[model samples]
Target: MNQQALSAFIWSVADLLRGDYKQADYGKVILPFTVLRRIDCVLAPTKQAVLAEFEAKLAAGVNPDPFLFRKAGQTFYNTSKLDMRTLIGDPDNIAANLYAYIQGFSEDVRDIFERFEFATQIDRLAKAKLLYQVTEKFARVDLHPDKVSNMQMGQIFEELIRRFSELSNETAGEHFTPREVIRLMVNLLFVEDDDILSKPGVVRTIYDPTAGTGGMLSIADEYIIEHNDKARLVMNGQELNPESYAICKADMLIKGQDVSNITFGNTLSEDGHADAKFDYMLSNPPFGVEWKKVEKDIRAEHEQKGFNGRFGPGLPRVSDGSLLFLMHLISKMRPAADGGSRFAIVLNGSPLFTGGAGSGESEIRRYVLENDLLEAIIALPTDMFYNTAISTYVWVLSNRKPAHRKGKTQLIDGTLFWQKMRKSLGSKRKEIGDADIVTLTRLFGNFTEAQIATLFDANGKEVGRRMVHKGEFQPLPPEGGKIKLAPLSRIFPNDAFGYRTITVERPLRDEQGNIVVGTRGKAKGQPQADSALRDTENVPLSESVANYFAREVLPHAKDAWVDEEKTKVGYEIPFNRHFYVFQSPRPLEQIDSDLKQVTGRILQMIGELSA
Candidate 1:
């Protein structure tokens, strides 16, 4: 069946089950059924071949591994006594047959999911007859090997999870990272590096601490495969949520991914993979979640051997311990002893400049900044995710930066970037187009700062341009006078430069003893005439000389201003520096005579024209 028809059928099943369960809870039913159906479909074509091969080995008195019954290239395993065609061939005993089918799969595909947690939950399906109906409903539409590629199946799974996340809103932010956001993160982190793509058999491990659905890791894997045929990607992750953990494990199995290290349990409290490090790590941990209630052993382990020293600035605030996960990921960074690593994480704005002054969070920021490990921080637009519409940022950290980027951080204000997809879900939220993604990725790859611009004020005036320069203001002088220096600004509404203004207001007394005043004074504590302006009335004439003298005069003439008693005569170079204006070899007298003759000729020409 076409994708639309298939999706409509599956969504109907999920919709039916959703009435009895939470919106988020629908994934528990739909995801597993979808996985089983696909696996069964794939196995059906090869079922006879697999059984004959098993019988041949048995007849030869040679028993191969039972797990080989579901080999990588096989259509499906011959585990159940009744496959979809026979069980659904008669719908009465469908539930009982489906239960048997699942058991058969558990036994046949043991090695594939030997370490997964789904085995514990599969028994619960026996009580829910609706699940069998859903499975039978899924059976009607074939998701077989020839009908759907593994990637297409993955897409369907991702879309269902995304829809569930949208409908439920409970695990909306925690369970899924939007595909566009994941694409942007992957592009920005890898578009420039030839190291990951150019080398064949170069094993680069991709990891996520909270690998909800394993979308981020899988997408990155696909991206690498697209670029290089021989690129080897090893995906590893640690997930705390059981349903999502189970779904991720099932996905790897269907895709034929080696998920030896995809582990369950809280990554922060009891990391499932402590000794392993990765070359590329990407994640979107649950925002504003706390895990400080970790067991004392975990805390002691952290203090003794984990990231306590790295995050020693301060323990994160008790309410939201998001940074704890980031620190854990950083601790697992590929040591320089191994090949270097890079990481990209999506976070809210709080981490950028939160914690007030010198807070533990601030210390963390300071350490990261001073060490120059922060490569770039891209601020995504608002309402980009399915959950809360809070603004987010992508923090890109690299242990090995190119020489030019050392000791500096690139802050990409991508909040303004992105184009809305034609079929947008709602306001301030949209999918980024290919052009948008390309532009953003290129900007990130080139580390270009030219496109950076600032927002305007309430009046729409650009802040950077209109905000007065506070360096120093040069005060206007009286007619033909020298320029003067002004002090720094100390009040609002000061001139272009940050200066203080004082208004003077005085009353005029009338002859009748009534005050008819024209009020005036320096605008509140304005400076009296500056003492440096020795004589305010004696203004300098030459403009250039005035400018030069204002800048160069004071420091050079500090000790030269010898005051004898009250009236002092300065015996320094008082010659006007303006003489250089006429210092040419040709005299002005000859030039003026020539100008007079030319003026006479012009006057004669005007008289002739009048006549």
Candidate 2:
């Protein structure tokens, strides 16, 4: 089916659930049913062939994996009671029959849905009169294997997740990584390396701890397929959401992928990929999330072994556990000899400058930086995800680096590398176009650093190149730069951790001779404007405001002041005129005259009080 037709079909299914659920909640019912219908369609073509092969295998007294054994060599087979065709045929009995079928199917693929107790959820839907309608609508949608190719199916997964993210008003970081992002990461992880693609004998494993609907894993699979190479693409993932977990497992089943390895659990506390090291790791874990340390045994084990082992050094602060996820992925990196791992993690600014020195979070970053495992950090543009317009960063870490990138880290400022979507479309989710991906991928592949500034030390010396400002215009380079238009690369010295303060000045008055406070700038062809308070200097205005609040506001607050303090009525200063209105400093002689008048007034007041 074409994209528009397919989208319309999916939207129709959504329409059925319109009143019953929110747009975001509609996916809870539609996603699973879509997977079921697709699986049924796949089985329809291969059913007889698979069943015959399974019979032969059983006759030969060979018992294979029941889930795999039942299907034999084909992608799917109809187990007597619960196939999609059978369930949809009897629409009246669909709620009960479909529930039974789902239960039976889950049992067969038990390993994939470890903690996923879908029966209760399914039952709830059934009681609410939802299963039949949703299933019937999905049966009409063309998610069948033949109708939509595997690549198209993956696109559908992305579209659905994106739509859901949009409905919920989630942040860009909360939405799943776009295909372009995944493609860039795949390129970074395997830069034209034929060994990972063309060699089947080489056992290579890729993992995504926060895998949402298995997009990253499937993209890796598709990458291997497109290269026309044969490598064992063992994909493992852990997802915490039960609904997403069910749908992801169904996706794996439809593609006939090995589902035993893709785990369903909270990755931080109950890591599903425990003891298994991966060669390539890619994930866009939720940007800012808090995790309960309920699994004390796991926490204690990692703590005892030290942070470098699993956690590295110190645990992250309780509120933001983003670094902990990175630490876990870092620990899963194998040595170079045993298919060394490289990771591309999408993160927000929190991990980069969150905790200060001696904090557990800082120690983890320090460990990675000191060990030189960090390769590059790229800042992406805002509005890159479906829900939010906040900027995020991607950190590339490699356990095994090529000789050229040994001691250096590359930082690319890609915040300006996106094309804005039409305001009419107004899709909250913005995306990096193909051109941006090629540019980012090629720059990463080449490890360029020219635009990147080297970090400096407190003593006015350069340390090493670390990060690029996200403000660089990714415009076409000049003719002589020899830069590729698709991907630009430059080399710079490393930016040391050292930082220095630079000062800039603003005039005290406008051209009109009006005193002003705070910064002022002009719009093109428009008059210059200052801040709301009209303060000439931001520093003085801020200091005066702070002093006014502390001395005037806080001292008089009823909740904070005691009875004794309440009786003390200090002169309340007029905040607006006292704080924002700027006045010229008096000359020294004028200041002396003012002090003499103030002293005489104070003496008169004292004499009156004495009388």
Give all TM-scores, in the order shown: 0.68, 0.69
- Per residue, candidate 1 scores C-alpha lDDT tens digits across 400-495 of 777767665655555556666666542326666666677667656765443232334455454431111234333333333332221111111101
Note the Cα lDDT for every prediction shown.
Answer: 0.62, 0.64
Q: Write the per-residue lDDT of candidate 2 for residues 385-504, one digit (tens) a residue.
A: 665556687888987878888766666667656777664122335667887788788778766543433344555454443333245654433333322222223332222321211121
Task: Give the number of the best model, judged by lDDT.
Answer: 2
lDDT of 1 at 151: 60
Candidate 1, residue 341: Cα displacement in angstroms equals 0.1
How many collisions between residues are there in candidate 1?
18
